[model samples]
Target: MSMRLARPGTSDKAETSPLAVRGLTVSYGGDPVVFSVDMTVAPGQMTAIVGPNGAGKSTLLKACLGIVKPLAGRITAWGKPVARQSSRIAYVPQRTSIDWDFPVTVIDVVLMGMYRDLGLLRRVRPQHREAAMACLDRVGMRDFADRQIGQLSGGQQQRVFLARALAQQADLFLLDEPFAGVDAATESAIIAVLKALRDEGRTIVAVHHDLSTVEAYFDRVFLINRRRIAEGPVSTAFTTDTLHEAYGGRLSDGFTARRA
Candidate 1:
């Protein structure tokens, strides 16, 4: 099933805000994993969430998308609570979670993105097909749309998932570890597509590793380690002091090149 793209609104009105979080907290089996946190994601920005492993970067993304319930505080998307605005939010989880044995085609998986708008019973229309193809083209995966997802390389699979997110036509995107385990070229392609989306007035938040690429890739950075140690433009937030705070007193692995 597929959904038709909503018509673009008038340019006069300001673009809608993307996401807001207040006093947010998360826990695993009653153990608090993230402390109270506040954040707002503006339209047309690419923000990277970074920290050491188990720093709650993925937890934050999951909390914002309503996949993991917050122990305290509220999350709002486009001024509505996450539960009420699921359709406007798109999520791309880690590729490791995908079942490689599944016999679905790349296009089929990408088409699933529209299922939320199409509901359950409807078939994908020509418009949906066209939109899906366009999204694939944007990610440079149009030629592989018919191939089985399992047959693709790690980078190709990543692009396929990105195409799926594009098909959703969402205003806010939350991508977890999209660059992990992919080749440098695939990483570059994903970053380019994300920048294009940001340029087109969409909001994107990603859980990213590779401290070397943080400044080169993201406009804003949120350093997290169960709490928000710092958040602001990359130039301000990627400092040694903030890195130490976010990485539990160790500044070696988290500092940007300028600080090293």
Candidate 2:
């Protein structure tokens, strides 16, 4: 849990952070959702992007993945532009954003992660299928490999999507609301898998909503509210004062009562 939170480009080591954003700004039509935010994610640890609803946590994550263009800023993974490092990055978006009715089976969705390595012809060989199955097994979904995606419960679907990301074997994992709408058991299972990955020296940046679990689940925390609020180890940064600054009136009495 003892991790450093370096600013972007402050030193040679900082420049090599798993993910770095400098002066990022984004808007939909009129006003900006995120404005002039700077962030640095340390490698080999799980970092949570914590903020109130509609506070642009997801937008910031999307910008890192190049799913949305920034108004002004630079985003890099491993000291290079994200576009140049796509193969080393894997993203798992919010489950609510997916179309559960899609006709693809569990294994089919998992294999999609291998498309990058399959080349232009996109052939699915036996070895690729075996790899995909292994990924499903990692998330305890191998028994549902042949089932339609829509038939599974919300937690099951989340597990399958995570399996897809696992199949990619990327060094950095970006997830949006990973524990959203999931049961306690599923949440525990997912966190266990993510922790195992962090133990393997992989980096994880997740848009986490649960304040109670923030200190327990993440090594670091980035508190954001339209801009950078605080960034450091959860033990130091996940404080009542900082949480209030990021969540303001949205945060309940239970959080305000907790000690830093």
Candidate 3:
């Protein structure tokens, strides 16, 4: 599903976009990873952040979630600071960023998503467990709720993380490589669930690796290479020129030929 998006540089009414980043600049050590970037994620659309390796795609997502402090720029969700809207946002980090060896049960990891609502003092009520189970069921992982998180296969682990995100019942989802290590079936299932969320009017933004599937899975694409290269609907912004600009010399001749 797609919504009519405002043209880049055009004015949008307050609180209209689920996410808006302006003049974003992030640095680690002395080098900047993301520089002077601007992005606006349309509500109810699945948006992809695409670029070559080491292009700061993950950093951009982290900056949006306030996981990394930006050297410059503003990030807001519905016109409010991201820090103030933490509960309304659900984040799924890269599987590689997680400690799969951590000793946590599948259900326990999912229950953690409810901490914002459950608070530090409240007990884990039965209704909360039921809701968590429903989220697991949605991701086809209810049967593995009692299993150790470290024991699951990569795809299963990704599904469990998605379940954790779903448990938030959030309005804007920021996922980092949700399909990186998953099998084809798992990828299909995850995309289906994400599309379902978009159908429900939730906004989804992800750091995506598969260029071939960008047009298929996302309504809008933001091409980046340590900076804002291009961003808009897939049909308009995801062109051969933009891909070349973002991926640089990394893309194969055959790939460019195919895109051409």
lDDT of 2 by residue, 1-260 (tens): 02223444484554789899988999987788998888889999999999999889999999999999989998888889999999999999999998999899999999899878987797899999999999999899999999999999999999999999999999999999999998888899899999999999999999999998998899999988887888989988888878878887888987678653
- Compose the digit string of candidate 3's lDDT tens values, residues 81-178: 89999999999999998888898899999999999988989999999999999999999999999999899989999999999999999999999999
Each prediction's total of clashing residue pairs, residues at least 3 apart in sequence or on different chains, is 0, 0, 0
Per-model TM values vs. the true structure = 0.89, 0.95, 0.95
Worst 10 residues of 1 by lDDT: 1-10
| Native RMSD of candidate 1 (Å) | 8.2
Winner of 1 and 3 under lDDT = 3
Candidates 1 and 3: which is better by TM-score? 3
Residue pairs whose backbone atoms clash in candidate 2: none
Off by over 4 Å in 3: 1-7, 11-14
Please give the TM-score that candidate 3 achieves against the real structure: 0.95
Displacement of residue 256 (Cα, Å) in model 2 is: 2.0
Off by over 4 Å in 2: 1-11
TM-score, prediction 2: 0.95
